[model samples]
Target: MKHLAERARQVIPGGVNSGQRSIPGLTDLVITHAAGARFRDSQGREFVDYHAAFGPPLLGHNDPDVSAAVAEAGRTVDLCGVGVTAGEVELAETLAELVPSVEKVLLTSTGSEATFHALRVARAATGRRLVVKFQGCYHGWHDAVSLNVISAPEKVGTHDPISTGILPEVLQATLVLPFNDAEAVRRAFAEHGDDIAAVILEPVPHNVGCLLPEQEFLETLRAECTRAGSVLIFDEVITGFRHHLGGWQAISGITPDLTTMGKAIANGYPVGALGGRADLMELFSSRPGGPAFFAGTYNGQPAVVAAALATLRKLREEPVHEHVFRLGERIRTGLAEVFASLDIPALVTGYGSVFVGYFMTGPARTYDDLLRNDANMFIGYRRRLLEHGVFELPLNLKRSHVSYAHTDADADHLLEAAASAASLARGDVLDLTDASTMGGADAHR
Candidate 1:
């Protein structure tokens, strides 16, 4: 495994395609193949997968239905960059039908593109340049919304851009505020409402360990956006099809002007969608006399579209949500019990099929609250679990997913492994000088 990881590093930056894939303490693993709820590594070791490839594979990896659909699509249709395909129309229509606030839809290759186009449309529609985003809610890697996600404690309320290459004006145009703070939303809207083009958020800030939004906060955003004529965009890339087919808007009863979805929408395929009101979505260059420019060569490749359609069909026909939600609840409850038994200060949080274990006291409703989390303990516990044949990302605040293929027996096995992992992690934490405090030394280790 180390030899392969070294070879990968010679070719790819950081031995992984995504920066997040390079965990600090855990050994680098090369997965061989996957099916159902488990996968085999290069060493031929099997483990139950809770990472779910960062919340894709909602129906589990290598689902026969989705694979067969992709195969059939490959045999019949391929990319036709010049004109539209039937699969594109079907996927767009399916998105419009499933989502309540989506009157029209556009396809993209990734969530980042979907969000980028959504913001562009909002700016063009309102003729404004500024956008409002919460501190911990990550929209994408784009310059407009790339600031202040999982920021350091000192950089919490400041203009903490993730990368250095972003222009200063781009960072200044984005207003960063705390999540679940209705008064903050009101204050921002009162001061800069006229200049604000959009207010984008992850309704539930799952990026920072599932900080559930207060109902009043969402309501305030909707009301303020309407008053100012600024577009409201819910970046549901993490919560969209994972929570409900209609997205979080249906569950919250607070509709936004636009919504961005990806991840589980296509069960791990490369596909993304931007959907919202027809008047707003029609601003794209594809429409007759529309001014906003939008173009992508691989926007609706036939095989990817087929995978998305198949995933959606199974989600509608089968008991996918029910099964995954049940497993999620069991895991969350079991984790809480395990941590409580060990007398560790932790909070188990999630909604639907997502779960996160934060080593903190009480509930976390905002990024500020998450500052109290014991980062060392959180990572230590997850790394220990990884050693015990249960796979979850060792990074703190990253949520774990439960897929449709996971069963009650798998949940039980996870809990049992978690018990042992927690005990070992507790000892490791005790060895640290500042074990009881946040930001302990070597926290990432």
Candidate 2:
């Protein structure tokens, strides 16, 4: 595993394509194979996979039904970008039926592309230049909506770029505000309501450990956007089908004007979709004078569309949501019990299949609240758990997820590993001969 990563680094910029995959100590072990709830690393070490490929393995890795559908579609389908296929039509119809806000759908190749196009459509429809996005709610890595996610609390309203190479004008056009805070929304819209093209957010902001929106907060945003004639967009790349069969907007009962979906929607396939109101979406139509421009060579590749169709069908047939939610609840309760028994100052947060362990005493309500967590300690604990064959994301501040394949036995194994990891984090050292001195160290440890 070490040799493979070292060789990969010679060619790949960071030994990994994505920054989050570059775990400090564990990046050496490249995954060789995955199936069901567990996967094997290049070193032939097997671990229960809680990362679930960052929340896309809804039915677990290498699901036979999904794989079979993709295989069949690939064999029969011709080259992409030729024209529309039956699979594309079927998948589009499925999306429109599932997502309450989707009257029409435009397929893309990734979540970032979906969001980029959604913003373009919104700006064109409203004839506005400014966009409003909440802090800690990651839409994607696109330049327009990428600012302010994972920024320091002190930098909440700064509208600074989280990455390099972003245009200064892009920063000026976007207004970054606090999540779950209605007053922030009111203030931004009050000052520049007519100039705001759209207000986008993850209904349940999963980028910061699944921060659920307050009912009144979502309601206020919806009302404000309606009054201001700004588009309301829900970036559900992480929460689309994980929370429910439909998007989170359906369960929350606050419909957005546009919604972006990816990740689990295709069950690990490369697919993204921007779906929304018919009138706004029609701007992409080839009416010779249509307003919004939208194009992608691999937008509706048959194999990806087939895989998504099969995955959604399986989700409908099986109790995937109910099962995963039950498992997530079990893991949450078990972790709380383990932390209490170990006397660790920690909290298990999130809803449905998503959760995170914040090394803090209280619930995490906002990005600022998460700042109180001991991030280094949390990463240390995660590394310790990794050593014991439990694989949550080794990166700090990312959410852990459960797939449909995760069972009660897997949950038990994770809790057992976590108990030991927490003990290790506290440096539980014992010295029988020096009992008197042990009390001094005990207080702080």
The segments of candidate 1 whose C-alpha lies over 4 angstroms from its true place after superposition are 429-445
Q: How does each model score on lDDT?
A: 0.87, 0.82
Candidate 2, residues 202-258: lDDT per residue as tens digits?
888776676778899999999999999999999888889888867888898999999
TM-score (C-alpha) between model 2 and the true structure: 0.94
Worst lDDT run of 10 residues, candidate 2, spans 436-445
List TM-scores for all candidates, in order. 0.95, 0.94
Model 1 clashing residue pairs (backbone): none
159-198: candidate 1 lDDT, tens digit per residue? 9876779999988999999999999999999999999999
Best by TM-score: 1
Winning candidate number (lDDT): 1
